[model samples]
Target: MAAFFKAVNAKIRSNPALSYLCSTHFWGPASNFGIPIAAVMDAQKSPELISGQMTFALTIYSATFMRYALAVTPKNYLLFLCHFINEGSQLTQGYRYLQWHHWGGREKAGVHGAVEEAKEKAAAVGDKIKEVASK
Candidate 1:
């Protein structure tokens, strides 16, 4: 069993790509990408669901790690990319939260406003039909 494992390791080491694939440098950032992916997906959800504290925390976290990714020995670009995406997503989420909570976006999108808007559109359409019939 040890011999088989050793042979596989030797094969992996023989290829530059395969060796990099087996390294933590590749897998660490690859797995960390899920956070950014999830953050991007969350952007589609209602801003009311966003937590201000958590969004702020993640923003700071991503920014810090982005700097670390650049400072590291190998300069992990994959990690930097992951954190860059996460930072953008978190900033977007934070903006949405502020807009919904403090900037009147929620009021404009509320159920009452939607119903009033629909009624106005229906009335306008009815008036247009009446005008066409009268002509």
Candidate 2:
């Protein structure tokens, strides 16, 4: 099991997008699982507090996921689609928490905003490449 995970980690590390995706896939669910358990065990701790922390964590995960999604190519469309659906769900949930509950801080806005920025930059670069190729 250890060797299997080690090999997977090495493969993921070879690509920046894969590294981010794998890290989130591994740690996001792990932390999410523990957050509820910890909250339940600690009566004195507020559930809202736990939820707020989770939203913040999810925001980071969503941003990293966005970067990974943007880096994926058509050759990996199926794999990208699978991760997109999974990560997009998390992104939506995190955004809802911020919009409705206002539990998370402005950091969510900044990180979430990066997704749009990355998209714009990628489009511009693609356009430039096309223009150069045409010339």
Candidate 3:
């Protein structure tokens, strides 16, 4: 596995995008385990083709998002969908939010739509929580 990683790293260093990927992987443990953990939990929608259930993915997303929320705030649209979904809401009410939701699917069509739906949902939830958090 180490050798494989080295080979991949070497290949990536030779390329542009791949090199960036390797660098991030090598020095981006925070995002590696954090964003996915944060985003997944904070995620309102789930991708149909992913390996795990919607709930599982949400959990992963939450942690990852929380880990890098501050650094990625400017790019929140991509990382968390919105500022409303900052660490406070996602970490505090994550379980409550995830309790009843059960997204089920496994199709290629509407993949982008599904992700967008989930992001919208997450943003809405974040907004609601943000309102409460401010109060």
| Model 1 ranges off by over 4 Å | 1-4, 111-135
Work out the TM-score per prediction: 0.76, 0.28, 0.23
The lDDT per prediction is 0.95, 0.56, 0.52
Candidate 3 lDDT over residue span 1-135, tens digit each? 999989977887899767654554334443544544555454555432233344355555655654565565343333443323444444434443333334322333455578889999999999999999999
C-alpha RMSD values across all candidates? 7.3, 20.9, 20.2
lDDT-sorted candidate list, best first: 1, 2, 3
**Model 1 over residues 4-65: C-alpha lDDT tens digits?**
99999999999999998999889999999999999999999988899999999999999999
Q: Which candidate has the top score in TM-score?
A: 1
Model 3 residue 44 lDDT?
50
Better of 1 and 2 by TM-score: 1
Per-residue lDDT of 64 in model 2: 62
TM accuracy, model 3: 0.23
Worst lDDT 10-window in candidate 2: 39-48
